[model samples]
Target: MSIKNITVLGSGIMGHGIAQVSAMAGYKVVLRDIEQKFLDKAMEKVKWSLQKFAEKNKISKEEVDIFYNNITPLVDLQTAIGSADLIIEAVPEDFDLKKKVYQELNSLAEKNIIFASNTSTLPITELSKLTDRPDKFIGVHFFNPPQLMKLVEVIPGIGTDSKVTEEVTNYINKINKRPVICKKDVSGFIVNRVFIPMVHEALYSMERDNVSMEVIDSAVKYKLEFPMGIFELADYTGLDVVYKASYEMNLRDKAVLLLHPRIKQLYDSHDLGQKTGKGFYEYKGDNYERIDLTPEKASKYDPYSIIGVATNNASWLIDNEVCTIEDLNIALKLGMGLKMDIFDFFKKNGPDNIMNKLLELESKYGSFYHPNQYLYSIK
Candidate 1:
């Protein structure tokens, strides 16, 4: 089915951006929230963002006005989604809350309307079970600030219909976003599955070796050419978010993964990175210079070893049939904000070299670094 009317539930950070992008893409969008005040604030943010886009010449002023006209903000969920062709939920990452929303939507929504969640880590299959239309339920996970991020992970639940996947993929493309299909409903999905563990390992390395955060961050930034170091990205993403993701993943593999003590300490203290103004580094209104971090102390840590764990997990995704190697590379490059394709890096460094690095890391960090069969097959 062709989607023209899109309803975005929850007018929070992810919700407002999704609504704005949908409207900008020429779709009629309904942004629903529990309170009028929240909706009003969200609308204001959207307006400011659109104006900035217009000023930057990314969009015309006339187009911004037209986009604003396409969006309808409301407090009534049923009314907002009454005629919606597709509804994307961007609520908090609580499974119980999400299940409740899906149950309510199941009772009130039209039979043919597609149901999707923007959940970062929850299992799609479990969420799909809460809905009446399991075949139409899927995960359309978008990166933060959907207006800027280009990658969206389209995941299919165990019972999702093939046609529904195609329809959702088409609609995402219509919004000028790239879609990386995750064939399985695994924990952390594609990008997070590979990315988060690497961040965790980096934290583990720093704490274990008593290394400076700046050294590790600078090494990953300059040597690997990543947009930011893992810790820096963690701060930007919120340390709590990174911790929760790691905690959740560990539950899935009880014997293997563990949240490093430093991350737990930071999360417990509520110094959750950019949002809280303190994390691995301090942020003073977009300037980190106040922290007095010296990035010149190059790390003793091996860059390939850290990246190998990530590519090792990427290989596992291929082994488990989550996504294609090409799609995994695309998702990693875009979703993780890397400047280069990981596979290309692997080619330049050689598969044997990567395998040796994984072996070395596994010897030190345990089975989480153990190379998947796909890596073995590479040579």
Candidate 2:
């Protein structure tokens, strides 16, 4: 639990944020990237963040100086990570790139040093195969904007040592973040596996003429009562990101790929929701208002009731021991920003009713509506 030095590989958004938080926590943080320009840009971002904190009165100017002083940008892996007690790999999600990082880390780290990946999708068990100490390796999935977010999904692969897991969890808590331990490594871990599918279905709903952005969004606002509608979130998270992930999910699992021609067309055209300034609606400005005259129809009769049913099914994941009641709640709140505990949501509306509704959606939406097998047995 005592980390004197930490190394953050990659100078991308996640890496810089990781370094920022680590430096703030008083650890000597070294952020590594290939080129000097990348490190320069990352250093600028880190300074900008600390300055923003100072401007907002979150931290004093002197404190910002202290934090920035603790952070160093490094070009050489050996110099950056040689003495690191902990390493957080935040490189690209590409497998080969990550494995290369792993090889370099394996050569540098001592037998006791822990290695963790900041990946959202790649399997931890697979990553463990590359490292000599799978027992010392774990998945530490931090949500974006690490300083603001509170939750970290701490996933341990099949061979990951329990002691290593506990130590890493303690370190995560030390950084003032909540750690949700995933007992087994599953694709997308726990939150994204369930949540991403929901996003995928929403895209399918949009394409199937099942609903309009305005209607789906309104029904979601009025019904399930998410902080923001799914479409709005899609815009924020970038439609292209979810689309590609879903397509991979479909490719991996023969179940419910949503191969509907209309959906495919959207993917092919690269109409990513908010980031590219297009998706269900052409997004514009900070609030992401729609610029198009697309039909704002409800895809189904009483879609809110139906979405409630789906979330109800999601609750059963707890009953089946897929994750604890607290883990599920934290996932929604931290990973997706739901307002309240999901256990409360499930207790309010039981699971069997949800199962029946999932069936209803299944019949209407084809593969998009297949009931999650995890939900059926939660009774």
Candidate 3:
């Protein structure tokens, strides 16, 4: 099915970005929120972002106005979704709230209107069950700031129609973004499943080895060639988001995906990273300033310990058929902004070296670090 008119159901951070990118892609976008003030604020941010694109010469000033004008901000849900061919739900991550929204959408939207969610960690299968048309529902997991992020994970529920998945994949491509298919509707999908454990290991190392956040961040940034250190990225992503994702993943796999105490502490205190001016590191204000991680500090921590955990999770995903090695590599490189795939590092460091690190981590951190069958086979 062809999707022309798109209705975005929220006006929050992810919602607005989704709308912005949709508009930029020349789709007629209705950006809807419950409150008029919220809609107004979202539109202003969209305008500001469009202006930035013009300033960067990515788009002409005329094109900025044209794209910005493509989006129509509205408070009426029925009116916003009335002419939509696709309804992308960017609402808050609360399951109950999303269920209610889908119920309302079900009652109001046309029968053929495809439904999509921009959920980061929630299972697409469970969410699809809430809608009348499970075959029409899918997960389009966009990273933070959808307009800027190139990676969009296309996840299909068990009940989701394959044709629907293909159409959405094509739509994502039309928006000038990289689309990676997550074959199974697993918790954390592909990117978070493999990456979150790496973040957890970083936190664990800090607590266990007395490694400073700066040292860990430095090692990840300099040694691993990631754009940001794991701690810095956590702070930038907001500790609450990171904690909630970890919490959700843990709920599904309690033994393996346990939450880190440091993350929980930050979340409990509401020091939610850059948004709150503090998390693992302090930010000056609402503006995000990258933490200065000195390369000299990289020597204090072995970045391979973190990579070992990530490689294990990647192996688990591959073994379970959640995604292919090629897709996982693309997802991590694009979604996490890594210089190279985790598997590349795994191969470079060699299976024996990575296995030894995993064994060491397993001894220190319980069975979660235990290498999987794939790792053993390689060894």
Q: TM-score, each model? A: 0.93, 0.87, 0.96
lDDT of each: 0.83, 0.73, 0.87
Clashing pairs in 3: none
Ranking by TM-score: 3, 1, 2
Residue-level lDDT of model 3, residues 110-166, one tens digit each, is 889999999998889899988999999999999998989999999999999999999
Give the per-residue lDDT of model 1 (tens digit) for 1-379. 8788999999999999999999999999999999999999999999999999999999999998999888999998899999899999999888888888888898899999999999888888888989998899999999988999999999999999999999999998999999999998887889888777777778777766677777777777766677788888888888887887777777775533545677789989999998888998878775554333234654444466666777777777888888998898889888988788776565555677768877876787687667778777765
CA lDDT, candidate 1, residue 197: 78
Ranked by lDDT, top first: 3, 1, 2
Of 2 and 3, the candidate ahead on TM-score is: 3
Itemize residue pairs with steric clashes in candidate 2: 210-299, 211-298, 211-299, 212-297
For residues 1-379, write the lDDT of model 2, one tens digit per residue: 5668899999888899989988988889999999999999999999999999999999999998899989889999889878898889999777798888888778877888888999887778889999999888899998878878888999998888888888888888888888998776755566666666666556555555555667766555544556677667766676655665566556555452344343456667888777677776676676756332222332332443345434543544554566786787788788887777654443344555655656776687554455555544444
Clashes of each: 0, 4, 0
Off by over 4 Å in 2: 207-209, 251-270, 286-301, 304-316, 343-354, 363-379
